[model samples]
Target: MAWDDKRVETWVGIMLRTGVMIAAAIVLIGGVLYLSGRGPSPRNNYRHFQGEPAQYTSLSGVVHNVNLHEPRSLIMLGLLILIATPVARVGMCIAGFLLERDRMYVVVSTAVLVILLYSLFFHK
Candidate 1:
């Protein structure tokens, strides 16, 4: 059982495909729930710009809302998962490089991961 480049690539491909599929499924379910629950005559207030609720703005808040089985929060969760897929792929690459003792790639992957995290969380 050797951890070769081909093996890593295969796993990465599987991970990406699985992540996207799961995220899409979650979003679809959430959308169905939302549409079913919303009775006829839905609110279509478009004059004023409205933002997401405070609970959905933060990760903790989104998780809390999801715990309560909120449809919007579930959709948010799906989106979050979708966004995280690439980040996780980068992390997996880092690990794969580390296992192969590839210093150059490990450093490059780490830098990329740091930049990604910064843009995702720290950018103003």
Candidate 2:
């Protein structure tokens, strides 16, 4: 019933492990789908060096493609989840610090969380 440091650490660890495992599973499934759809000898135009499509660059686009069962989009979504894991960890720490009445840590964690969000969403 207590929100102690050990308990918080344990939960954070669980969250990180679960996040990575889920991301890996999604990426693995996407890779399998990609390979299966590509056939035995898919094209490899290395010399051309075509970049990633615009659809995979934005969150909405990725979601749209994911809804359509696009393999690359699924991989992108997995990567996005992987990236979000640490941000979620920071958020959890903020909550833990708040519960512990640790003002200094709460302020520091909040700053870190804000910076992370700014960089992730607004730093263009």
Candidate that would win on lDDT:
1
In order of appearance, the predictions have TM-scores of 0.87, 0.88
How much is the lDDT of residue 20 in candidate 2? 99
Candidate 1 RMSD to the real structure = 1.9
What would the TM-score be for candidate 1 when compared with the true structure?
0.87
The sequence of per-residue lDDT tens digits that candidate 1 reaches over residues 67-120 is 525687889999999999999999999999999999999999999999999988
Instruction: Tell me the whole-model lDDT of each prediction, alpha carbons only.
Output: 0.89, 0.88
